[model samples]
Target chain A: MLRDITLGQYYQTDSLLHRLDSRVKLTATLLFIISLFLVNNLWGYVMAAAFLAVCIRLSHVPFRYMVKGMRTILFLLLFALVFNLFLTPGTPVVRLWKLTVTKEGIRMAAQIAVRLVLLIIGSSLMTLTTTPNHLTDGLESLMKPLKKLRVPVHEVAMMMSIALRFIPILMEETDKIMKAQIARGADFESGNLIQRAKAMVPLLVPLFIAAFRRANDLALAMEARCYRGGEGRTKMKPLVYQRRDYMAYAVLLLYFAAVIVIGRILPI
Target chain B: MALKLEHVTYIYGADTQLPVRALDDICLEIPDGQFIGLIGHTGSGKSTLVQHLNGLIRPSQGRITWNGRDIWEAGFPKKELRSSVGLVFQYPEHQLFEADVFSDVCFGPNNLGLPREEVQKRARRALELVGIPEALYGQSPFELSGGQKRRAAIAGVLAMEPKILVLDEPTAGLDPKGRDEILGQIAGLKKETGISVVLVSHSMEDVANYVERIVVMSQGHILFDGEPRQVFRHKRELEEVGLAVPQVTDILHRLSAAGFAVDTDATTVPEARDTILKALGGKWDGPAAGRGAMGEKEKC
Candidate 1:
């Protein structure tokens, strides 16, 4: 059941966007994220929304799945909304007791809500289309310049992929442990708040042990296979830019230029 | 005591786009004091079937009965049914949580609302039954060796004193000696306590020497259910579903087909040896070759 909360999981369908090089998707996502910040006007927001809709349609992933994990970010959205709704200094829109919401505050909050939402959806699109392996490869490739500063890009990338890979395995382990505990007459459903927290102890302790054991075994297996650091290591499936990837970059540049023109360069 | 399933069909993610019928029209009966071995390869719904035994999972269709009454009836005590049919899951040692083996084993009895003193008594008895030393009772379960942890985990379930014990792959991942010890302990426990057992396992050889009956499942259907000799007779059918009969059964079957007057139904190694010796009229008087049968005749 916890596995249903999968965030930005890949949609396994053959589509133009899914086939694009991971590097192109990553850079396009960055450009889209930058565009979200650059555009403040309604027309700018409209362009961003349209671009996102087109990308989502291209991805072939269901609209419902794209927003399934968004429920988790509702608290963060509310926090942003509340902060921006009353904190800006401008002409008063509404006064309630000691608190007054300004017109500029309303404007800023609305723009922020739109921006935050579009930003999440746009970024999630990249992850939705690219497999975790490709995502890591793209990240390592993108961060190659940082290797001069000894950032350990490949190692970090490997860790990210490994962590992603472990998510399902850990979830399955948790499900089994929970069932085992339940079979032992450990009641988890009917308890009050404190009772529920106390109940989780039986579930959590064993999970941590299993995780450590798995990690230990994995480390030994890796060591046995002579897995030293990322030093002088070459990739089996090297990341390469295709002709379609270049075209995607071109389209992204055009989109960014349009956002700047409509959002900031022209009079509102 | 009897637990009976009637036309049980379980479909996972029923409302979703791709619903998997894990168990389809599965009808099974567990009578008292019967050591029934459930055999199947991976994804044959062996685990799902065991979960249903203790009312941990409810069937989507049909019904299950405890004794004579329906388990899904309006006023049935589900919790009572759970303890009545104890389930020791595969790799059960992972469920140990208490500071010591004694307390961990007591966890089930405690949940049963037994008195503290009684819980302690049951824990001790279970630990002894599983051959866990009294000295190790107070030590952390984490410190126990692999086989000890596994048996201790089984003791945790046995503490409930269930009438029917369902163990899913209890001997998996252990060395041959450890496997034999655990299986022997289980068989001994059944004899001493007179409790029914449902051993869900992968190895036909392990069950061949131990269980009275074998239920073979494949693709959510019971392909064969009878005594070991009768069930293993369908060797071709079982192997088609990615399951193999005991090694002795295989050798006996081949020998019988190869014009030897040997009984192909011999499931255990010693039984096969006797069958072949009788057929050949050869006196296997070699002291080492004349090994006695390790299994006792299980009376149901």
Candidate 2:
């Protein structure tokens, strides 16, 4: 039961996108997010959706895993549908018991849902190919220029990397703790709302304690390893922007231009 | 009575392309009221195998029977099954959260939905069984020392009154003295309560000294299941699976190889000593050795 929770966790695979420089992929994801928001028409959305589909294929990530990521946003999808369905004023499609379901409201809700689903899928695809370490390394490399402003970009990246690495460890720890409590007859499944919340006290208290202990130990170990923020530190695998990265960036620029032109010519 | 797994197979993400076979056709009968040791390296499926005993994990492919009844067959109360087969996981102290030790230990009996008076009684008995004194009852479990926290955690499980207590790496990270105390407590509890004990450990000495039966697992398969002496006899086979024989047995084997005439099957220090003496062609009090040692002691 514990294993079934979809964490948007990446599956290891060898593909064109997987082999690309992580910096390029990170930049592409940012561009893709921007492109998703830039789409104002149904045709633009269709183009964006096709782009995401091609990216997913290039990454060799299963479509099922992408849908798993969308599962977390299911509630938001329904909420958006309801809010748009009722709140937005439009030409009524049907009237039922003081409620009017409008054609424009339905179209807007569908568009919003499509946007959200696409956003989750696109982001998940990026994460699915690029490991958290590589992602952070890319971020650090991308943010290097911010060092002139004393932004401490490397420190942030390091912290993110560490947090990503510890996520699975902490999850495994939590699972073990839950099992231990269950062994002692802590019923987390049954009971009313208040009773269920009360049961979580047993699980949460220990989880917090374990998490703090882990943090302390990790800090001590890092200090012992001479980790002093990200200052004066050299990476083992230094990031280098290659010619292929430049080519990829150029392709994205061309795609953005194409999208702008297509939006004007084929307005929804 | 026995806990039996009949060709049980469990897979994680079985429908996915990258399905992980956690347990593969595992079939074994764990006898009643016996101290059995499970040894395996990490990811060898030892944890998955034990999780089935209590129905914490249901097998994807075969059956689990307790005393000749299929546990997975409809309408089996899995919660009741779990209570009957207690599992004390590694670092179990992390499970403690109640304001006081008593309340925490009572959590189990309370979950069984027993009468309040009966729950308190079981809590007291379980605490005593784990050697946590009544004086420490009102104290917060979080404030206790590491070893005490571990004892308190074990008491929580003991409070459930399980017929079979399964502990995974119970003595891990404890000092030798603390390890012995906890291991000794579990052994004593088994003897007193007549409950079957399954101790999962990587330490060969702990298992060799405490358990009557040793079960070796490798790559999601039960490699061997037998008495300590019987399992250690196949030293080559065990080593091939990245497991070592008990230290005393290893030392005895080394002694025998060096022409000391010690029996390699000797699993304990005292047994090894006796074997060494027999190999040296000498009695406990040899005629020349006893006289010389006595004369030396008198001169001293």
Candidate number with greatest lDDT: 1
In model 2, the Cα lDDT at residue A62 comes to: 79
Tens digits of per-residue lDDT, candidate 2, A41-117, equal 87788778887888788888778877766777788889998988876788998887888889888888887888888
Residues B120-211 of candidate 1 have per-residue lDDT tens digits of 99888888889999999899999999899999999999999999999999998998778989999999999999999999998797888899
TM-score of the second chain, each candidate in turn, equals 0.94, 0.92
Q: How does model 1 fare in lDDT?
A: 0.89
Which candidate tops TM-score?
Answer: 2
Which ten residues in a row are the worst by lDDT in model 2 chain B?
A: B291-300
**C-alpha displacement of A146 in model 1, angstroms?**
0.7
Cα lDDT tens digits for candidate 2, B168-225: 8999899878888999999999999999999998767787887899998888888889
lDDT of each: 0.89, 0.84
Chain B alone, TM-score, model 1: 0.94
Worst 10 residues of 2 chain A by lDDT: A1-10
